[model samples]
Target chain A: MAEITLKSLAHSYSKNPAEPQDYAIREMNHVWHQGGAYALLGPSGCGKSTMLNIISGLLEPSNGEVLFDGKVVNSLPPEERNIAQVFQFPVIYDTMTVYDNLAFPLRNMKTPEARVHERVMEVADVLELTSQLKRKAKNLSADEKQKVSMGRGLVRDDVSAILFDEPLTVIDPQLKWKLRRKLKEIHHRFRITMVYVTHDQLEASTFADMIAVMYEGQVVQFGTPRELFETPNHTFVGYFIGSPGMNFLDVTVRDGKVFSGEAQLLVDNRVHDGIARATSDNVKLGIRPEFIEVHQEPVEDGMEVKVEHAQDLGTYSIVYASLGGISLKARVEEDQITPVDKAWLRFPSEKIGLYVDDYRVELPHE
Target chain B: MNKVYNNRAWWLILPMLLLVAFSAIIPLMTVVNYSVQDVFDAHTRFFTGTEWFVKMLNDPMLQGALLRQFAFSLTILAIEVPLGIGIALLMPKRGWQASVVLILVTMPLLIPWNVVGSIWQLFTRGDIGLMGWSLRELGYGYNITASPVDAWATIILMDVWHWTPLIALLCYSGLRSIPDAYYQAARIDRASKWSVFRYIQLPKLTNVLVIGVLLRFMHSFMIYAEPFVLTGGGPGSSTTFLSQSLTTMAIGQQDLGPSAAFSLIYFLIILLVTWVFYTAIMNMQKDDNKGA
Candidate 1:
């Protein structure tokens, strides 16, 4: 495995760069350390795959350089870049036997026949496909075929990184869990640098050591899952990183005080001071669904809210409604029942996050 | 079993089955009737029970035509199958540009068959055709109209232009149906261009190529309009094929009985060959699709 660095990279589909905003992937800089597990997470059409392709040398950036271990490799083809990638669907050769499909890449590299056989056998063993080695690929189940695809990439130990682009999306739900755990096991054992791309928050948060949340062709935040969940650098990150996502409410602040609609909020002056510098006074308050507890009566530091709807999800309930004209959601215990008309909600100061213009206003711990 | 009654599906197939019987079965019955009888005055016909068939078996002209038919079918398939696959491999995969290129390539196939024959006839003519004129200018004697060598060249060239596009179109559809994931995986595997084609593209193309071969073979076996209009089985009948020979006997020479027998033999040959090709292709695909 080798470290990968992207230096001031920017790309656009147009020829002349058109305007200052005519970029599919905007300029930014980041480094992926060797043996680190990272993910590029985003919604559909958010340029995550484009960024992944650029890193794999499938597309050249209009203005920037890609360096592998401090050596420039922007001009190298994907093969020369020593990166292995798995696509959304299984892509093994239909006519070849399972053994042959795993052996193809090694054979192309002119690896010794004996060693190639050994490598393929080892991979098949790891994948639990030893019994099906002599069988043709077309007859296998979709999950089995995809396993062969993964085997093809992992057969070569010299490859610097293995890139996965929603590879588990086509897998059956039960198989997705098993394959993901297998991949994690493979990464832990091999210590290979891996970059996975997906729109699923759970997959990214669970698999990657660091998750890069992208929105509108730019990375909004890059941090550990806990960090992203607790202190999202941008409002988009808050909305994207959790189940049922995070609840957001607009609050206007003036004279070191926060106001949600007409109801005033009690926030520390130090927290208000950092937000005061960001110009836009239309501040946003963010809280995870888990943090906003639902109660029968308005508790201390709690706001009275109307419960619009309640979703039953076996163990917990999600109360969807608005608070002070802004939509917010609160997670409640499944056994507790709140009237559909109105309920009291609590937002603890420790769990409340403040943002200005979709970006978090970093708070002082004190 | 009695859950649903979809009688509307019956209405959909009634028209189709009636059309097939009217257009195909009735005419076939007529041929069968003619094959076993000797008609004196349409009403005074006598049952002749395999008499014409026996005579056709001894006819040297029918044998020659049959030989020529297989040879021409094989030659056309050899040229068109691989050429179609090669062109398909080079076709652009996406965008409006692909649509534009596809239309241009399919334009030849869309032309009327007789017109295509006439166009190629002029294009291969000794004095006026561009190919002939260019060949002569290059110090080679070429005259497809009266010379056997020229006649064969013209027929081969005409068949290639008219049919290669059909194969290419089929192959293009087959190639396009392949998902992008395959190519991406190939890239990651670092497969060479040849390995990608052999292990991926060619294996994937076998099913369609079987269709290409069968279709080309059947069409070339009965190919009449172009060669008949261009060569008229001339150049000492070197270009005479089965359908042309049948036409010569039935229409030109007015030998109705022999022609009827000859047509039955020709139809049987095509059916037998097609069955064999179909069986082989199906077996191979089944194995390929299930072996793993």
Candidate 2:
């Protein structure tokens, strides 16, 4: 296994990129630790697959270097780099049996027949494909064919990494969890460095120890799931990670007080000072819906919000409210009594984040 | 679930049945009727059951022609299939060059079949043609009229020249349909060029190859124009194929009863061979084992 490093890497499909928007991957420096399960998470066309392709050596970055274990491999092809990649669709030799499909990579390397058989059997067992070993790959279900593709990667002992580009897209919803758990089990057992690229937040958070949330051809945040949930470094991350996503309210500074319109928000003095010192007029306050406390009566440090709707979602209810003419969502416990028309809302000091020009500002936590 | 009985669909199929009868069944029945009778004229005919079939089957000239037809069909198929696949592999994949090459390769296919025969007949003339003149200048006695070997060779060459492009076009489309992911995956697996062709490309092209083989077999079996024009069944009947021999019997000599029998036999032979070819190809796709 190898730790992959991208040093000032940038890619553009255009021959001469004159602007930042032309590049598929913006110039950045990042490293994946050896044998770590990491996910590159983003929406469609956000460059997650582009980054994965760069690391796999299937694509050469237009600018900088990709070093595997601290050796420059930008010129090397995927075969020389010893990387295995599973694509969005399952790619198997249609005429080959499941046993042969799993054995393909090792056989290509001229591994001895005895060891090829052993490794193929081992991987097939792990994938629960033992009974299908004699069956042709084309006749199998979509998910089974994908497992055989993954098995081709796992059967090779000399592979440095396995890259997956949304490999579970064709699988049924109920089977997706089973396949995901199988992947986690395989990672723990073999300790292979796997970089999974996907657009699903739950899949990324569950599959990887850390996620690199990408936005507009750049990785905006790289952190653990909890860290991303609690402190998103970029506003895009704040909006992209959570289920309902963090609520962002546009604010302005007037006389060292942060105001949404005419009413002042209860934030710490450091935020107010930061707003006062900020040069850009674009400022926003971000807070997760789960952290917002809903009180039936007006209390100190709480602002009265008009209740638009309350949705009871089995475990908890989401209260859609308007605070000073700005729409907000606050998650409340199911046991709590529903507020009629007006409810008092409070944003926790530790959960509130200040932003200037679409990036989170570093404010002292209370 | 209870089934709904709807017989109106039978009415919907009547037009197709009438079309098939006019197009296929009626003509075939007329041939069958001619095959079973000895006719002096349209008014005077005698029912001679199985006599014409027995006479046509026992004719040694017809038997020799049938053998030659099989040899020619198999020979052309063997040469064209692999050659077409190779040409497709070598062809440029994209850009202006691809379009130009595609146009050039498909040029021969668009020519009328009779025109192709006429062109080759003139082109292979030993006294005036460039190819024959050049070969004669090189001190080789390459005459299609005198040597049976030369006659057979020229006819096969003319057919190959005219028809290999169809196979190439089919294979080119098949090659283009393969996604880039398979090649990428093959590279990642460290597969050699030959292994990639054997495992990936060849297997994926099986459907197209079946089409190419069946079409070439049937077309080559019925081939008459090219060989008839180029060789004219020359060199003492060495290159006389089934269709030319049948035409000589039916039209040249006007022996209607035995010629009709021969025509039915020839039709059955093509149908039988085509069915065999299709079945063999489709059987290769079946899985060896079915599991629970």
Candidate 3:
């Protein structure tokens, strides 16, 4: 296993890129620690797959060096790099039997027959494809074909990492979860560096120990699921990570007071200093919907909000409301009494995050 | 439980039945009638009762033509299939070069069969053609009319030049349909170029190749126009294929009964061979499916 490092990696599909927007992957340096299960998570066209391809040597970075275990392998082809990649759709050899499909890589390297057989059988067992070992890959179901594709990667012992580019896209929902768990098990058992690329937050969080949430061709935040939920590094992450997402309100600081459409927010001294020190005119206040406390009557330092919609979501209802003409969502328990027209909303000081220019501004710890 | 038997759908097939009968069945019946009778004139005919069929089957001339037809078809297939696949493999996968190469390759296929024959005829003439003059300049006698080997080689080459593009075009479409992921996966697996072609490219090209082989076989088996024009089936019937022999008996001379018998046999042979080729390819697919 080897750590994958990108040093100022940037790629542009255009031949002569004049502006930063031309680059599919904007310049950045990042490290995927050896044996760590990490995900390059983002929306479509955000360049997660581009980064994965760069690490796998399927693509050479346009501007920077790609290092594997601290050695620059920028010019190396994928075959010479010893990295395995499972594609979005199932790509098993149609003519080969499942057994032979699993054994293909090892056979290409001329691995001994006995060792190939042992490894193939082990992977087949893990993937629950033992019964289909004799069957042609073309005849297997989509998920089984995907498993066979994954098994090809697992069978090779010398691979530095196994990269997945949305490998579950073609699989059924039930089989997707099972195969993901199987992949996680394989990662743990082998201790190989696995980089899963997906636009789905749930898939990334469940499959990767560290999810690198990407936005607009850059990694906005790299943290655990809980860390991303509690403390999103960028406004994009705050908007992307949770269901219904974090509610952001445009605010202006005047005489050490934060005003969002004339509704003054109660905050600690640190936030007040942060707002005052912020240089960008696009200053905003952010808070997760889960942290917003809603009450029928106004409390101390509470702001009134109009209740537009309250959806009953079985376990918890998402209450959509507007404070000072700005829309916000709050997740309330099923038994929580929601008012028809209005409610008092409180943004907890501890959870309140101040932002300037969509980037999180550091608030001094109280 | 009574079923509604709508007779209206049966009327819809009436037009199809009439077309098939007019185009196929009526002509076929007339040939069958001639095969069983010795016809001096349209109005004056005598029932022969398999006499023409027995005589024609025993004729050594027809047998030689049958054997030569097999050899020629097999030779052309042997040369064309592999050569076509090789040309397709060497072709550029994309860009303006690919488009230019596709247009150039498809040039020969656009020519009519008679025109293809006329083109090859002049191209292989010792006095006027570049190829024949070059061969003669190299101290070789390359006369299609005199040498059986030259006649065979020139006709085979002409057929290959004219038709290999069909195979190549089919294969090119087949190759293009294969996703780039297979190649990337092959690279990741460290597959050799030969392994990639054998396991990935060849397997994917099988469907198209089957079509190419069957079409080429059927087209080549009825080899009349090109050989008749280029060599005139000369060098003492060296390249006189089944169709030329049938034409000679049926149209050139007025031996209707024997020629009709020969025509039926020729049709049956083509049908049988095509069936065999199609069945073999299909059974191989079935094995891959493994009762899926």
DockQ of all predictions against the true structure, Cα-based: 0.59, 0.75, 0.56
True contacts kept of each: 0.75, 0.79, 0.62
Residue A225, candidate 1: C-alpha displacement in angstroms:
1.8
Candidate ranking under DockQ, highest first, comes to 2, 1, 3
The TM-scores, chain A only, for the candidates as listed are 0.94, 0.98, 0.98
lDDT of 3 by residue, A1-366 (tens): 798998998998899999988998999989999999998888898888888888888888899889899999999999888999999988988888888999999999999999999999998898988888988888888888898899999898778999999999999999888989988898889999999999889999999999999887898899999989998888999998899899998887777787777777776778888887888888888999999998889898677889999998788988999877788899887778867799888878889888889988788766
Clashing residue pairs in candidate 3 are: none
Q: Model 2, range A279-358, lDDT digits (tens) per residue?
A: 79888889999999899988878989999998889899899999778899999888898787999988877788888888
Q: How do the residues A286-354 of candidate 1 rate in per-residue lDDT, one tens digit apiece?
A: 889888777787677666776788888889888886775667788888678754878777777778788
lDDT of 1 by residue, B112-187 (tens): 7788878887877668989877889898888766688878878988889888999999999988888777887788
Q: Rank by TM-score, descending?
A: 2, 3, 1
Q: What is the DockQ of candidate 1?
A: 0.59
Return the clash pairs for model 2, or none: none
Best by lDDT: 2
Cα lDDT of candidate 1 equals 0.85
RMSD for all candidates, in order, please.
Answer: 2.8, 1.7, 2.1
Q: Model 2: what is its DockQ?
A: 0.75
* Structural similarity to truth (TM-score) of each candidate: 0.93, 0.97, 0.96
Which should have the higher TM-score, number 2 or number 3? 2
lDDT score of residue A291 within candidate 3:
96
